[model samples]
Target: MPSTNCTTIYKLVQRAEDDDIEDVGNQLFGDGSSTMSVLEKKKRFEELYGVVRPDAIHAHPPNVVKCKGSGSRLPSKVEAAKKAAVKPPRRCGKCHKMVNHDSRNCDKERSKKQK
Candidate 1:
């Protein structure tokens, strides 16, 4: 079975060319899976490197905080959250399933039986 460290190891391989590659790799492998908790990793890297990582790591919405709600409020909150969660929608023009995901993400409505 492949270890969870596979990803960190793969990254070590990919980033081997960078100046800080050795330091990052050492941090990752030194801690078992080298999978630092997201917050810890972010904090550590920002402290050490003096730069923020990419949007993939930091894209959580600022105004969003989770709390319990019920009934109409829950649905309304969900709809509003969805609106706040907007990314450019990736619906396929042909089938309209979020084809941006993978072929499996192809929309059922969009997938027609071709004769």
Candidate 2:
């Protein structure tokens, strides 16, 4: 796409309603003399592409009802998730608590061994 003239590409993008397409025009020619009002952009875009837009023939908003479900979690499922998120503290054999030392480095264990 970059190999083509920026002005030519800008002409194609001018008719595009999509942000991504418009960005291509802005990136190439910039918003300078080559750029124009919406009407001019549309005209140039049509001339360059030989159509209003390439996808104009098959353009339709997607019917996405299936993708978006009735957004809600059951109370039991929610409670299960909460329970899964929490876990009891682990007991350390040497230090007796999960807070500090383990078997090899426990200060209490060291003291007992010294005795």
Candidate 3:
């Protein structure tokens, strides 16, 4: 056999390994092996399949507080405490008297004028 240099043997082994890898890749993926890189493959895939956009599934409505009338402003801590201390009597709409139950479910005797 002719004398071969170590560099020549190394080059041959490297070429054989590369060819084996290419052959296995060609077997796995189809034989139309383009010279495109990984990034190029990703770009082509994006161009063909398009990108997916995520949907807002957990979206929520904005919280809003509305103020109406002259005394609709938020009360202070001291004013709230005083209002809580002096609990006003609830008046019934039907009987027009201070009662524990509301007008909707009042058991008071109706007057002749109301009837």
lDDT by candidate, in order shown = 0.63, 0.67, 0.68
Model 3 over residues 28-48: C-alpha lDDT tens digits? 443675566666665555654
Q: What's the count of clashing pairs in each model shown? A: 2, 0, 0
Clashing pairs in 2: none
Using lDDT as the measure, the top candidate is: 3
Question: Using alpha carbons, what is the TM-score of model 2?
Answer: 0.21
Off by over 4 Å in 3: 1-4, 32-115
Q: Which sections of candidate 2 miss by over 4 Å?
A: 1-35, 53-61, 64-115
Q: How many angstroms is residue 112 displaced in model 3 relative to the true structure, after the best TM-score fit?
A: 99
Q: CA shift at 44, candidate 3, in angstroms?
A: 23
Could you give the candidate ranking by lDDT, starting with the highest? Answer: 3, 2, 1
Per residue, candidate 1 scores C-alpha lDDT tens digits across 1-115 of 3776898888887777674766676664454664667788677767677888777665665897556564353457778778756756575655556534334545543355442
- Give the lowest summed-lDDT range of ten residues in model 2: 27-36
What is the TM-score (0 to 1) of candidate 3?
0.25
Off by over 4 Å in 1: 1-20, 28-34, 51-115
- After superposition on all CA atoms, how large is the RMSD of candidate 3? 21.8
